[model samples]
Target: MPQKTNLNYWIDYWNRTNPASDLMDEESLVSFWDKRSEDFADKIATAGGRKRSRENIALLEASGFCAEGARVLDIGCGAGSLSLPLARAGAEVTSFDISPGMLAQVQRVADREGLSVTTIAGSWWTANIDRLGFREKFDLVISSMTPAIKDAETLERMITCSRASCFYIGSFPGGRDAILSDLLSRIGKIPSPRRPPMGFLFPFMYLYLKGYRPEVTFSRRRWNETLDTKKAAAHAIDIISHDQTVTPAMNRAIQRYYKETAVDGKCIFKNEMFLGMMVWKVRP
Candidate 1:
């Protein structure tokens, strides 16, 4: 369990923030790729495939969300990270996103692989559900590292549309193991208020409120990367300089941390974190 004090505070703060803020908007979401997309795309395209892809697929399978001849809806499916793999596994997939650039990329991948997928270009929050004609038409609805309908109304909308199950991915707030916190603290900046583990909490609370017992699983992945320390430091500098809250002094401090942490011209960076997934059947 996460610290209640910090978790609640963050959740409250996030709730008060604009639900449709740029962070949640499609354009803002894709803008995250502006700096690293080309490099990242090459890395991903060349890495053969991500190891995390298999892990995610396994998690979904264990939860009874198999891809064998089932229909799956991936909201906020950026560049077909999961969608492509699912399609290859023989599932009919519909991926929706807010960025035309991302959708274009997804199309290119699908076309290259000769895989057919329905692509929707729209904001998840404002998408016309009726226009899609997919109400209660999917076996699984998934949102990875993206916000789920936070409030009850949106939750109901998502549930009503999910025929069998829904899966949400959210960060665990205020965990001592948060990688983002470590990165920020190196710059003498206080971490942002921790938000509720909506990915885990939303489905749990939704099931609880509806008189059902949901099965919950907590999981974590440690990503270790070997990067040339000098290059890594430069990249970190670029990232912090662009952040809204980082100051010049803070940036220098972070640079120093990166310098000190480097070993033998390379650094092995590790991200320790927690996440949860919940699943429950909708009563007939």
Candidate 2:
């Protein structure tokens, strides 16, 4: 017989994988992404970005959330990867993010494409959906790889805010580049083997126990990016030390790795990661 896990066990496991960080505090998280807004915008314009966006949109269509004239809310809609395409598809998209910089980029693209996407700046964890008229307002709600979907309460809120369906995508632990993994190990911080996808398992199981049948899809893709040595080094630093200052030794190691990997004026890093998608219809 299969073992049954309790709710507390799943919640605790999920929390362990997603540790709270002062650096990831609401204000700090906003500031961190505000600085990377432009770079992220450029990334989403690349081939890999288009690939992921295409798949996400396809899933939405398959899940019956891509109806025309549908009101969609994209939580943590960074750089409009999903929002822009949906807007162009004729959906009324309301894209929300904690960083104003990200929202600005989304609006900028929306204007250029002649697609109207309403952008809002706020953190889902602390935002009042009722005050913002988001309570049960959207035909489709999406929270893709966002820190906002942290617990059961948040998951319930996401479903409650949508009239029809809610779609979510999140990491599956082993989804980082091997180069970054090596660097982290060299620095004595070995990556955890516990997959981040396990984080999504809790919600899926919890929903099932609540008598809701959630449809799920699993996807794995290798992300490849080539950047100049400087950019590569900066990216490594950001990943290795989220909010902490990179020590001299760590910086030296990162630069050396980038220097060795650079070819034709670019440093390339390729890594495979898993993404889990869950879609639940809120109303029949």
Candidate 3:
């Protein structure tokens, strides 16, 4: 029997936690992102949010991979957060996402600005990379802070498709989500007492083993979200259901919590976030 690699360990851990098949199927997943598109667009349009996009591009360029004329692939690009900015910076970008609604947001901007962005809608998990001509076809491939890149297969897909470089950014566990925290405790899902796993570590270590010394960096910020209370409540229930069987009582409790906290039908969730990023040039 072969020994398990770091990638195997990470995949096992991700499967245990995410349960992608059980939680959401293709249609429901698309609907999920479609519903969140409006809210995602609103937040990413904000000053702070826009600044974050600029910062990501700047960091990527700082690693010596210039966006100008680069063939860029942004996986799970929600509302074109990085895709739009990168396109504006002269990259010929392919903005790939699962939601037609979210891709429409990118298409709108591309039409208005005539930026070189091609929006494609499909699940990363279901994408046929070879048939799509994606393997080693990009100068840079990015999978940043997306649940889609949970397993080794997804992580390796980035590597197989990139000729020049790859950048990945993912969240650190144990952030402060005011409403989620309360609802979690109410439903008997208090956060683990043990220390949480470091974000992006497994991916970074995996890349290192494959002979790339990725530049790893950590960032912390506060995200202030303005959510549609009704939609947000339903979404929260969907999230809660993934971890535990959401009983009818638990569902109502989540809804009631959202209603009580919302002001004028909008819920503002303020939370601090810590993220880890790794960038590496593809070795010859």
Q: Which predicted model would earn the best TM-score?
A: 2
lDDT of 2: 0.78
The C-alpha stretches of model 3 lying farther than 4 A from their native spots are 1-23, 186-199, 226-232, 241-248, 262-267
Best-to-worst order by TM-score is 2, 3, 1
lDDT of each: 0.64, 0.78, 0.78
How would you encode candidate 1's per-residue C-alpha lDDT over 1-284 as one tens digit per residue?
A: 34555445554554555353423334444554445444544444644346666767777888777797989888777677778888889889898766666667778888888876888877666666778886898888777765535555555666667888776665565444323355566555444433312455654554564666655667775555666755665556554443355666766676676668778766676656577766656552
TM-score of 3: 0.84
Candidate 2 Cα misplacement greater than 4 A, ranges: 1-5, 12-23, 186-198
1 against 3, candidate with superior lDDT: 3
Error of 1 at 121 (Å): 2.9
Q: What number of clashing residue pairs does each candidate have, in the order they appear?
A: 1, 3, 0
lDDT of 3 at 143: 87
Task: Give me the displacement of residue 275 in model 1, in angstroms.
Answer: 1.8
Clashing pairs in 1: 10-194
In model 3, pairs of residues that clash are none
Model 2, 41-101: lDDT tens digits are 9988988898788888998888766557989999889899999989989999999999999
Question: How many Å off is the CA of 267 in candidate 1?
Answer: 3.3
